[model samples]
Target: MRMMTCRLCGSDDLTGVVDLGATPPCERILTADQLDEPEVTYPLHLRVCTSCWLAQIPPLITPEETFTDYAYFSSYSASWVEHARAFVAGLDLRPDSFVVEVASNDGYLLRHVVERGVRCLGVEPSVNVGQAARERGVPTVTAFLTPESAQAVVAEHGKADYVVANNVYAHIPDVIGFTEGLRTLVADDGLVSVEVQHLLTLMQLNQYDTIYHEHFQYYTVASAQRALASGGLTLVDVELLTTHGGSIRLWAAPSGAPSQRVSDVLAMEKAAGLHDISGYIDFTERVAKVRRDLLSFLITAAEEGSTVVGYGAPGKGNTLLNHCGIRPDLLPYTVDRNPYKHGKFTPGARIPIFEPERIAADKPDYVLVLPWNLRDELIDQLSYIRDWGGRLVFPIPTLEVV
Candidate 1:
C-alpha cells in the first residue's frame, strides 16, 4: 500500500499518533440475523501532518456508507438539546435572517431557529433523520454538502446569513472541499460557526475513543485556521467548549480580523507541545493505560459476581469497547435512549442494546458509562441507580466509580 497524504494539508509527511488496530464502523448497529454473517472492519490508525499539524486517519470508509440512514439522533440527550438551545440564543439573528445547518441531525439545533421565526434549512445527509427533521416542521434537504450541493441550497433558499456545522466538521474526508462548501453556503459577509472536538483536549485528557472512522480529522486552533484559509474563510474568534469532552467552536467569515481568543488557544496549544507534533508521541501510552484500567476493573467486577452493564451506546463508546476488546460476556448489554438501537448490537463488542428502562428493572450492580463526555448530565440522570446500591462507572480519562 502507498503512503497516503494528509487529508487537510496535502502533506506527504504523515506520522503516527496511535494505531487503534481495526474497528467496525461505530454506528453500524447489527441485527441478530446479520451478526451471523461476515462483518466488515477498517483501519483506524490516526496520524499528524508534519507540514500543517492536522491529525487524521485513512479515509477507508465513505460518508455515504455511514450516514445514509444514521443511528445518531442528537435530540435524544436532554443536555445536548439544551446546549443547542443556548447556542441559538447567542447567535445574532433576526426573523428575516436565513440560517442553514449542515449535517443537521434530526433538526435538534434548527428547530430552535424555527421557533424564533427565523428562516432556516437543514442540509442533512441521513435520510431517516432528515425525515424526522421535516416531520418536525424544519425544512430539510437530504444530501451531502459538497460544493455543488451547497450551490443547490443557495439556489433555493438564497445565501444564508448564519451557517452552522456543529459537530460535523471532522466527519468529512474531503476537508478542503467541505470547507469550500461552507464558504459557498454563506454570503461573503456572513458567518460560519463550526464545533469540532479539540485535538489539544484529545491528547492531554486521552480521548482516544473519539478516534473512529467517521471522524477523519482532528484539529488544533492552528491547524483549524489553516483549514479555514484553504477555502477562503478566515477565523475571527474561537470559544473553548466542554462539549464532546472538550471542543473548540470556530467563528469564521470570508474576511475578518482575528480575535484575542484565537491567539490564546494557539498559545495554549503551543505550551501543550502540540504546535510541532511532539505531544503525540506519548499518546499511545496513555490510550493503552485506559484500555488496561477498564479491562482490569471489568474483569474484577465480573469475577466478584457483579452485574455490569453499559449506559448510552454513543459512537465514542464503540471505539473504547472495541479497543479494549470487550465482548458481550463481560459487558452483557448496554442501554440507549434512542429506540432505533433497542434491538441492535454494538459494532465490534456485539453487546446487546436495550431501552433505558432495562437498568431500572434489572437494578444492575454497575453501569459502565460509555459517553463519559456527558458526565454531569448522565450522572444526574443515572443518580437514581443509587437507590438500589447501583453505581455509575466511567472508562475514559480514568476509570472511576461514583
Candidate 2:
C-alpha cells in the first residue's frame, strides 16, 4: 500500500529518496514448520515530503500484523537497560507524579520509574511483552496509544506528568493520531519526550538498513517539530544521543518556548540541507555503494574459505541481509542474546538463529555484527572470538573488518 500523501502534513508533494526493494517484515523470523510456506514481501521505498521534509515509508502492513507478537525485547540489551535507568534518574518526579511510557516493552524502562516510587503505566500493544511487563510489577495496558486510548488512560490513571515515547515514534503509521493522543494524555505543563532515529545520521552514516516496514517515518528535528506542533505541542528542548546509531530525544510541552538546543539542532539540520529536496538525491547512490561493498566483502570471505556468522538477529539486520541478498552460503548462521529469536530463521534471508554460545561452539572465522548500533557492547561481550583469531565485521557506514 503506497502512501498517496505525506503522513505528517498530508502533502501530495512527495519525492522519491531511496527504494530498498521488496522485503519481508523485518522481525518476522520463521520457525521450522513455517519455513516452507511462502512469505509476503512489501516494498521498502522511502519518500521525502517536499512540504515538511519528513522522510517516510508507506504503511504497507497493519500494526497488528507487525507488532501483535513482537520478537524484539528491550531488556535483552544490558546497555539499553542502563540507558533507560539513567533517563529515569535524570527526571525529577514526585512519588505521586504519573509517568506513562508508550510502547514500553517488557517493563524495561518503566521498572526504574516504579522503583523510584513514581507511578508508571505502560501502553504496550503486544500481549506477550505486556504480560511480561505485568509480571515484572509494571502496570501495563495492552493497547496501541491512540486518542481514545489516551483519553481512557487519563480517565483511569490521571494526566501524566511525563509521557515517554522512546524509539517507538517511527513505528506508528498514524502520526497525527498518536501525537494528538500525546496531547490529550499529558497535562498542560507536562512533558512529552520522544526519542527517534535522526534522519541526518541515517543519510550521513549510510544507515540504510534502518529503513523497513515497521519504521513508517524517519525524522529530522525540523520535521519532528512540525509533526509535534500539529498535536498542539511545542518542541521545548532537544538532546542528541548515540543510541540506535544516532537519535534525538525531543522534549515537548503543550506550551513552552523552544530551548537553545532545539534552535541549534534545527539550525544544524537546515545548514545540512535537510529542509530541501536536493539534499536527499545522493542517498540512493550511497545505499547502493554500501550494498556492493558488503557483497564484495562477503564474496571475498567465501572465496578465502572463511566461515562467517552473524552476531545479532535484529530487524535492521534483516533489512541489511535482504537488501544485500545474503543467504546461508555466505553467512551460515547468526546468534542472538534474545531467546525468542533462537530456533528461528531470519525473515527472507533464512539465516538460522541460535544462542550466543553457538558462536563459541562453532568458532566461525568471522562474526558479522548485525545490530551495528550496539557494536561496542557486542564486541566486548564476544571478545573471546578474538582468542580464536575470529575477526568482527561491520556492514554499515562502510564494510570494515575490526
Candidate 3:
C-alpha cells in the first residue's frame, strides 16, 4: 500500500500514532452461517503531520468501492432525523439559496431544507440512497462527489449557495480531490458547513471506536483550517456540537469571502490548545487509561454473575466490544432499535442482536449501553427496562452504572 500523506497540509511529515491491527468492517454484522467466512480487516493506524497537525489514515478504499453499495441508513435513528430537522431549521437559510449536501443519505436533512422553500441537491454515491433522496423530491446526483462531478453540478444548478457535508469528510480517500470538488461546487460567496468528530474530544473521551475504516481522517479545528486553506477555502466559523459524542460544525468559504466568525473561531481554537502538538502526544496515555477502566468494569460485572446484555448495535459498539475482547459470556445479546440489525450478529464478537422487547422477557440484570454518547436519549428510550429493576451500564471515558 502507498504511504498516506497528510490530508490537511499535503505534507508527508507524519508519524505513526497507533495501529489497531486488522478487524472486520465495524458495521458488517453477519448471520450465523455467514460468520464462517474470513473477516476483512483494514489498517486502523493513525499518523499526524508535525507541520499541519492533521491526523489521518491512508485511503484504503475509494468512495465508489465503499459507498456505491452502501448499507448505512441515516433514517434508522430517530435522533439523527431530529438532529437533521433541527440543523436545517436553525440555519438562517434564504428561500432562494441553492443547498447541496454530500452524502445526503435518503435526503434526511435536505428534505427539511426543501420544506422551508430552499432549492436543494444531494450528491450521493450510493445508488439506493441517492434514488431515495430523489424520490423525496431532493434533486440528487447518483455519483461520487469528485472534481468532475462537482463541475457538472456547477453547470446544472449554478454554484451552490450552501454546501452541507455532515460526517462525510472523513469518508473520502482522496481528500484533496474531494475538497477540490467542494471548491468548484461552492459559489464565491457561498459557505460550506462541515460536521466532523473532533479529535481533541475523541482523545479526551477515549473514543477510539470512532477510529474505524470509514473515518479516514480525525479532524481538529486546526487540522480542518489547514486542509481548507490548501484548497483555497477558509474556515470562517465553527460550533462545537454534542452530537456523536462531540463534533465540530465548521463554516468555510473562499479565502476572499467575508464572514465575521472566522477570526473569532480561530482564536477560540488557539485558546483551546488546538495549535499545540503536545496535547495529542499526551492523549495516548489517557486513551490507555480508558481501556483499563472499561475492561476492569466488564470483568467485574461478569464475575459477579450479572446477566449482561448490550443496548444499541452501533459501529462504535462493535469497536469497543472487539477491542476489549468481549464475547458472548460477558454480553449474551445486544438489542437494536433498527430492525435491519436486530436479527443479525455483531461483526467480530458475533454477539446476538435482538429487539428491545426481548429485554424484559430475558430479564437481564444489567443492560450495557453501547451508544454511550446518547446515554440520555437511550435511557429515556429504554426507561421501561427500569420497571424490571434493570440498570444501564456504559463503558467509555469511564465505566459507570446509570
Candidate 4:
C-alpha cells in the first residue's frame, strides 16, 4: 500500500497501528429499502505517525456525509448525561460567563449549562440533534466548525469564556483547521476543554473497536501538544477519565504553565513506549485475539442451539460486528435505546435493529453488548434479563460472560 500522510503533522512516514481491514461507515445504518443496494466501505486501518506518533486513519469519508443528519443522540444514555451534568456543574463559572460546545449533540450537556443561568451555545453539524438541542432551550447553531464559522459565532455572541469540545477532537480530519476554529471561538484568556479517548488506554486495553471511519485520528500527549500549538493553544493540564474505556480531558488555554498531571501523563506515555512507534508493535495481534474469542463464543452458542442477541447498536459495535463478520444468523438481531435505529439494520453486518425491550421479549439465552464502555449502566438497565437465566457478553478488553 502507498504511504499515507499524517493529518496532525505533515509526515509521510506512517506505519500501521492496527488494521481491521475495511468497513461501512459505522453510523450509516441501512433501512429496509436500501438493503439490496450496494453499500460503501472504506479502509478501517489505524496508523501512527513515526515522526509525531499521532494514530490516524485515512480521511476516506467527510464529516458532512456522516454528521449532517446524525443518528447517535447523546441523551440516549443516562450515565453519559449524568457525566455531562457533573462536568458542567464542576466548572467555576459565574452568571456572566458565556460558554460554547462544539459537536454538541442534542444539547445533553449544554442544557445543564443553561440550567445554571449561564449563557451557552452549541455548535452542532447534525441538523436533527441540533434541533433537539434548540427544543430543550440550548441555543444551538447548526454548522460544522470552520475558522469562519467560529468567527461568525464570536462576532455575534462575543468570545466564549469557556470552549468545550468533548469526544469531538478525534472526529475531524482537518486537525489544525478544527483546532483553529476552537481557538477563534475562545477568548484570548479563555480556557478550552477537550475530551478524547486516550491512545494509551486504547493500545494497552485492546480497544481497537473504536477504530472506525468517523474517528479520523488518535493522540498521545506528545502528539497532542503539537496539534494544539498549530492552532495557537497550549496543553495546560490533563485529567484521565474513565469515560469511553479511558479518555483524557485536556485543559488548555492560549498560554499557561504545564500542570503536574500533564507532565505525569507525558512521562507515563514515554515509559509505555508510546512516545514512538515501538508501543504499536503488538496491537494487531491483540485485536485478532479479541476477534477470535468473540467469534468462538458465538459459534459455540449457535451449535448448541442457544439463542443470542445483541444489546446496543453503537458505531463501535458496527465496527466489531463487521470486522468479525457477524450476521443475523449468529446475532439474530440487536436492540438499541435510540428510536431512530429501531427499523434499521447495521450498515455492513445487516443485523436487524429493535428496541431494548426486544431482549426481554425474546428471552434470548445470551445478549452481546455492543457499547461495552457503558457496561455498568447497561447491566442495571438489563438486569431483568436474569429472570430467564440470560447472560450478557462483553467482547472488548477480553471476552467475559456475566
Candidate 5:
C-alpha cells in the first residue's frame, strides 16, 4: 500500500515513529473451516504528523470493509454497561430531549437514554449490530455517519440535543467528514461528547497493542481540538477517564459553547510534550521492550512446564499476539464472553476462541489478560482461577504476574 497523507492536517510531512511489522485485520476473526484459507496482512506501521503531531496509520482499509458485519458487542462487558449507566445518570436530560449516538454498537449506551424516556437514535454502520439495536426498541440507522447522513437524520427527527460518540473517534479515517456529521446533526445549543483513547496514555503505558488498522488515528488534546475545529466545532470541556487503559471524554459544541475545561487539558498535553515530535521519539523502543518482556514471560512459562492461556479475544489482543509472534503453541486457546466470537479463531495468530468455561475446565497455570485495560474487571470475573493456583498476567506497560 502507498503511504498516505495525514488524516487530520492533510500534511505529507509525516515521520515513521513505530512499526509492528505486518498484522492481520484486528476484528477479522475466522472460523475453523476457514483456517486453511489465505489471510491478508497489512503493515501495522504508525506515523506521526510533524505539523499537527497526530499519531495515525495510513488508511489502508476502507471503513466499509472494517465496520460492516462487525463482531464486537459492547453490552457483553459488565463494566462498560455500568459506565454507560453512569454517563446517562449524569446527563441533565428531560423526557423530550433527543439523544443521538454515533457508532452505537447494539444500543449498549442508548438503551439507558431510551429507558429514561428520552428520544434516542443510534447510527451504526454494521447491519447486524444495528438490527440488534432496533430489536431492542432503539431507533437505529444502518449507515456510516457522514455529512449527508447527518443532514438526513436532522431532517427526519430534528437536531439532536445531545450527541454521544464513545470510542468511535479513533476508527474514523475521514476525520473531517465524521466531525462534520457531528456538527450537522447537533442543535444550536446541543452538546457533543467524544470518548477516545488518549494518545498520551497509549505512549505512557506502552499500550502499543491498541495500534490497529481499524484505529486510523490516535489523538492528543491538541490534535483532537484541531480536528474538531476544522469541522466547525469548539472544544468546551475535557474529562480524563480511566476506561480503555486511559481516555479523554471531550465535550464539544458549536462556536459559542463555554470553554469549561478545554484550556486546562490542552495545557496539560502541551506540558507533556504532545505538541511536538520530541514526545514521540522514544515510543518505538518502549514498544519493543513490551514485546520482549511478554515473549520472555510466555517462553519461561512453557519451559517450566506451565501452560499460559489468554483471557479475552479483543482486537488489541490480536495486535499483541500477532506482533509478538504468539500462536496456539504458546497461548493454546483464549476465551471471550461474546458468543459471536466464541467459535472463531483470532485473526493472524489463529488461536482458537472458546467460552470462558474452557479456562476453568483446562485449569491453566497462567491466564494472560489480553485486554489489560480491563485487568481489574477480568481478574474479578476469573478470580476462580486462583482456586487452582493459577495467576493472571498483564503484558503491556510491563509484565506483571498477579
Candidate 6:
C-alpha cells in the first residue's frame, strides 16, 4: 500500500504481477465470535525489481510487529529440531561456548545446546514464546532484534560464539539493521548462520504461497551476499538444505574470511541464472501454467460431484489454499498430523481441520496434498486412503494425481 521499493536492491522500479485478491493474514485464524467482523487486507501483489532481480510483496508490517507475537513454532516440523541439534553438534560447542538464536520459539534448538553444558540465550520477540523459552531454561530477551537489542544482549550474556537465525532472514523488513545486530552480538571470530528459503525454488516450483505480508523479501544467495555485505559481513559458506523445498544456509563472518563453499555456490547460482531477471520472467510463465492447471483440475472435480479433502495444515498450505481462492466449497476440510493444529481452522479460507484418522471415516475421493513440498512423506502417511478407493492430488509445480 505504501511505497514499493525492493528491499534487496533498493530499487524503486517495480512492475505489478499477480494479485491474490484481498485477504487476511494467513495465520490469523478466527474464532466463531470474530467471524462477523471485517478483516485487514493489504495488496497481495507480486513485483519484480528491474535493478535487483528480487521478487517480493509489499512490506505492510514491520519486523517488530510480525515477530513480536509469533504463532508459527519451529518444533512443529519433526526434522527441524534434529536439524538445529545437528547444527550445534557440528559447530564443536564447548562448555563455555555461548550460542544464541534470534527469533527462537519454545527453545526448540537452544535446549539441545544447553543440555550439552553450553550456555545459551534466545532473543525471542514474542512475549508468549519468550516466556516459554525462559521456562525451559533458555535465557531469553523478550524484545525485537535491533542494534539496541543486540547491545543489551551482549551486556547480559557476553558476546556469542555462534548465532543462528533459521528461516527468519526473510521475515525482517530492515535487513541492514538486523545484520548490524548480528555484527554487534557475535564475537569477531564467531559465526552467524542464517537459513532462508531459496527464491529460485519458489520460482521453479511456483510456490506463490511463500509470499506473505510477513516475508519482506524472498532471498537468494546473491541477494543475501549483498545484504550481509552492507553490515560489513561476508557469506563465507553456503549449504543447500532440503527443508522448505530447498533453502540456502549461509555462514557469514567479517569480510575476507577464508571458507570453502562461498564462490562455488555463488558461481552455481550465477551459472543457474540467479543474477538475471530473465530467469524470474521464465518462472512467472511457469507459475501461470500451474495456476491454470490447478484451477482446471479443482473445477472439474467439483463439477463431476467429487469429494475433495486436503491433507496437512502447514503454513505453506495456508498460502496455497488462500492463493488458489479455495474455500470449503472446493475443499471441505483438511487432515493434519500435528495435534496442535487439529480441531483448529485454517486462517483465510476457514477450512475445517481434522486429525489424519478422519480420512478413514470420510472416504473422500481425493485428498489434496496441501504440503506438496513433503509429498513423499505425506503420501506415505496417507497411503491408506488408496485402500478406500481414493487418490492424492498435488497442486504445485503442477496438478497431478499421485
- Ranked by lDDT, the better of candidates 4 and 5 is 4
Q: lDDT per residue, candidate 6, 219-303, as tens digits?
A: 8777788889877788888898877888899999875563567677777767767676556556556666776787788889999
RMSD of 1: 0.8
- RMSD to native for every prediction? 0.8, 1.1, 2.3, 0.9, 1.2, 2.3
What is the lDDT of every predicted structure here? 0.93, 0.93, 0.81, 0.93, 0.91, 0.79
Can you write out model 4's per-residue Cα lDDT over 230-313, one digit (the tens) per residue? 899999999999999999999889988889989999999999999876788998889999999999999999999999999999
TM-score of each: 0.99, 0.98, 0.92, 0.99, 0.98, 0.92
What TM-score, to 2 decimals, does candidate 5 have?
Answer: 0.98
Backbone clashes under 3 angstroms, per model: 0, 0, 0, 0, 0, 0
lDDT of 1 by residue, 1-402 (tens): 798998776879999989999989999998988888878999999999999999999999899999999999999988899999999999899768999999999999999999999999999999999999999999999999999999989998899999999999999998888999999999987999999999999998889999999999999999999999998899999999999999999999999989999999999999998888678899999999999999999999999999999999999999999999999879999999999999999998899999999999999999999999999999999999999999999887888998
Tens digit of per-residue lDDT, candidate 5, span 1-402: 555788887789999879999988999999989999999999989998999888899788998998899999899889998999999999999879999999999999999998988999999999999998998998999989999999999999999999999999999899999999999999989999999999989988899999999999999988998889989999888899999999999999996654647777777778877788778889889998999999998888899999999999999999999999999988899999999998899999999999999988999999999989887788899899989999999997899999
Better of 1 and 5 by TM-score: 1
lDDT of 2 by residue, 157-220 (tens): 8999999999998999998899999999899979999999999899899999999999999999
- The residue pairs in collision within model 6 are none
Task: For model 6, state the Cα shift of residue 326 in Å.
Answer: 0.9
Estimate the overall C-alpha local distance difference test score of candidate 1: 0.93
Per-residue lDDT tens digits for candidate 3, residues 1-402, read 576677666778887766666667777778778878877777677777877777887777655656776657787667888999998887777867888999998898998987888888998889977787888888888878888999988888899888899999888867778888998999888889899998868877778878877788888877787777767788878888888999989888886543456566566656656566555665566666767887777788789887889998888888778777788887889998777676789988899999988998888888889988887778888888888788988787777887
Ranking the candidates on lDDT from highest down gives 1, 4, 2, 5, 3, 6
